[model samples]
Target: MAGELAGHAGDAANHGIDLIPIVALLAAAAIAVPIFKRLGLGSVLGYLAAGLLLGPSGIALIADPSSVLAASELGVVLFLFIIGLEMEPSKLWALRKQIFGLGVIQVGLCGALLTGVGILLGFAPVVAFVFGMGFVLTSTAIVMQILGERGELNSPSGQKMVSVLLLEDLAIVPLLGVVALLAPHEEISLTTRLISVGVAVGAIVLLIFLGRRIMNPFFGILSRAKVREVMTAGALLVVLGAGLLFQLSGLSMAMGAFMAGVLLSTSTFRHQLEADVEPFRGLLLGLFFLAVGMSLDLGIVGENWQIIALSVVAYMLVKAVAIYVIARVLKSDHAEALERAVLMGQGGEFAFVLYTTAVTAGIIDGPTNAIFTATVIVSMVLTPFAIIAMQKLMPKRVQPLDGVELADGLNGSVLMIGFGRFGQIASQSLLGKGHKVSIIDNDVEMIQAAQPFGFKIYYGDGTRLDVLHAAGAGNADLVLVCVNKKGDATKIAQLLRHEFPLVKVMVRSYDRGHAIELREIGVDFELRETFESALQFGAHAIRVMGADEIEIEEMIEGVRVRDRARFEAQVLGGVTAGTGLLLSNAEDQARESGIAPTVKLVAAEEKEERAN
Candidate 1:
């Protein structure tokens, strides 16, 4: 009877759902995320580290990783939804050349090369093809998160990376179909396959058309209702509904979610929807990455460490070289091309999906699938380190200034130091008003590039007084410090204020602290680089939410005036700018400006109540 009871308990433990692993996973994340972020390794790596600690290979605390992974797949779906929401249809259309052109060539060539490698390793042709296709994909979640964190998503290199990843996502459907054909599964007729494809296309079109028609009104009502929970639920429903529609029609759920996002991108509710779903997307995606770490098979890795290492090195080398060649062919500069190659050299999350599909379809046996999965995981685990290494190895290249000479009497009323994006904008605006502008920058490449645009930029470090004198800073009416670095800006501002005291200095600051430092150095005209842009964005958002234009403009102006006053007051008083001080000053300013103090008080009270 005791033995029978123990056996029954064992059965119960096996069959019954347990919450311990879930608790453990959350606890691991709670501890790991902050620590990793503090160490500057990022939260994705933190999740991976947490998973590694609690996984079967570590303490064996999580008995069933597949269950955790299954639940975490929702993160990927939501991630794709957010990505879609951020992208407009027109933008996607604009990227069509890169998406189809560079993306297609990268996959085709990478797939072929990896397949050849697999064949030489003694795998059958079908298995080699599966391996090649699976390995051609780089980790979209990891790459995007890293790049987005660095604020490079819209940069040239970032765009190229995104274009390639987009194509890979689209290519999954066809790749799966190919795997199905290669396997000994029950054969469907060619006509039926074609019909399936057509149906999938029709479903996508129907989704976009119907979504565009209904989503705007639906979100409008939700926004007017002003129930945050209801709005959040509505957002989730839209994403899941679209994802399910696509899944039922034999397309990727993520693909469907992306389509839904594009349809809603132009809606006024876009920002609200993004705000509602961002927290969920972030948490779930972290969980997804944690699940990936848990899925790594340490036993297999231990047994085949040498082969796994060789495979990973070979895979990255091959993909990196291929991607570099492709980027150059697509007109990318050497630095941008190398960055793309390094950023995209790892196997992606979809490898797990594809490998499972192949195994289930009997195209690849269990052992081969295990090896391939292990290889992919190892490559992904090393990707962040690879990115860091590549960045360190490939410093930004500055063009040579050989044979370049500044024009004689290069004196202008406006002396613009730094010919980067910020400097260019300020210079162009002044020039548009018919001001004579002389530009100076340390980046020789930038000066060379700007020459074709009729900009006569002198290559020199503006912080050096010799370079400034050579550029005729003494006779200039105003000196605009538009350098990229805060320290450099401050340095040039000090030099001008001390040496050329008569020349007015207008400096661009990176942030609040930098602005304060500039003010301390007696630069009267200082502009925070992104401050006005952010305020303008906020104004537009308020307008979209039904604020009157006149009222919005007045409110913006009042806030700006008050902020400037408060900043000056804090600097003069030698008080550090903290949240409490900021709020107190804002309330005082609002009262003085005859704004509604009750509204501000109520908002603050509500926020405190929510925190409680």
Candidate 2:
């Protein structure tokens, strides 16, 4: 009895200890992320600093760092999944040259150079090769986050970086096989390696095929069930299931997760799946960085600080030089190439994964892993600063195409500001009716794609007054602000309303609030983009619930007309009404207009008619 009690107490104590690390990690991130963000250092650094403080090297609060690392690795897996979600198969195909050509050259050349250097520095051939392959990868998460935050992900250098990162990610699959083959006790032959590769590839193809077949139906069922929690669970199941299959095949779990994401990218559930997995990805990734900080062996660093420092500096310098030279050789301008090189110079998160795997497989000892891991951490820590400094030194210049004005003998009285999905549909309808439509867009890729479709789209910022004039906006009979951004739409509308009152302005409003804002600004027409679609959907649901089709249609039409009038009245009244006031007004208007009869009044009238 006493022994049982003691065992229970021990279990309780162990659980308590586990909770301490969780609390500490959360608190550290909560404090550090906002503080760093406020200081303009970005959240990646904040997470790293949090990990550093709570790590074993600092206060030594958490004794078992390995467990944290094991848990946090899921972050990297989810990160890859999100990346896969973003990369539609069509987009990937379009970027094939960059992915295959530039990406291949970057990895192959960098790995070869690093391998040569490592061998000269007294490492075994296998070890050097492993290091070369691993160190050549850049941090996709960090670089991508920074570029996306700054809205540069579609910029020239950003596109190049993305291509390289995608290839590097794909390369991780085969690289893992190589790392396994190089392990000391693993005597896997060439035949075995080939077989393993075949199995991995087969597994991936099978997963993607099956996923494409079932994901749509599965999500359809879940969506119809109307349980958001269940839908989220289904998404998690897909990601984790793919990861499991990859792990079983002796491949990277992240690889499988990514494949799953790519497969589901075209599904109707893509947006919801992204939303569901994003929080998990962000939190876990932060924890992964923290685990990295905690895992750093300070003792190894203290003993070999000088050599570690020199190796880090040398590693960054060599990689930067190699990237810059290769980019320039590939026909990129000098400034852009320099920017790309500087941005991607650091050792990646994969270094930790590779080194850890090597240590586990007995290919490299603990001391070697420590030195390399420390170097990777330091390099990653310095990446944001490096990017900032490089940006300051080489500010990104928006180079306008030389002498590329609107094509001769092409004129349209209708001006479409954005040529995205919304604008494209509008332009097509207008064109089909024998009405000429002039389109302007800022996206280079979009402009290029539209040209092949026989659309003469001008590439320029629509918000700029000069660009507007160049596009013949001055003589436009109607200005259609179909841009995705609310601010951009508002700006174009405001510009047209003040500059050319004769020209009718039609703006796409994102939501009710946006429509109100646009109306307040005196735009002639404001179409709430998804409002009609939502109403149609609602009408269908009402019909499904056994309402008469004609009744549903009439009701929907009444509501739509009344709502539009109410919205216009509220806009003109300059009153920011709450939901309660809005509902009250809607009720009063419905009763006064006789659009909807009161239940009590209807019942009383029926009773009186029966009596008569």
> Which lDDT value does model 2 have at 121?
69
Instruction: State the C-alpha lDDT per candidate.
Output: 0.80, 0.77
User: lDDT for model 1, on a 0 to 1 scale?
Assistant: 0.80
**Model 2 misplaced regions, further than 4 Å:** 1-17, 184-186, 395-481, 484-612
lDDT of 1 by residue, 321-385 (tens): 99999888878888888888888888988888899999999888888888999899888888777
lDDT of 2 by residue, 1-612 (tens): 334534654686777753555777899999998998898788878888888777667777665677988888788788788778867798778889999999999999999988887787678888887776778888876777666554456556777898898888778767876787778866887888788878888888889777878887898788778898998999889998999998888777877898899888776566579778989988998897788677766777789898677767877888999999999998999887887888788888777778888888888887788777887878888887887687678754545464234322335789888989888887877888887788778876777777777777777666655467667777889888999987668667766775578888899999887787677667889898888788899899999999998989876876676576667665644334322222235545778897784433332444598899
What's the lDDT for residue 119 in model 1? 83
Assess candidate 2 and give its TM-score to the true structure. 0.67
In candidate 2 the C-alpha lDDT for residue 411 amounts to 50
TM-score for all predictions?
Answer: 0.66, 0.67
Q: Which ten residues in a row have the lowest lDDT in candidate 1?
A: 574-583
- Pairs that collide, model 2: none
Error of 2 at 15 (Å): 6.6
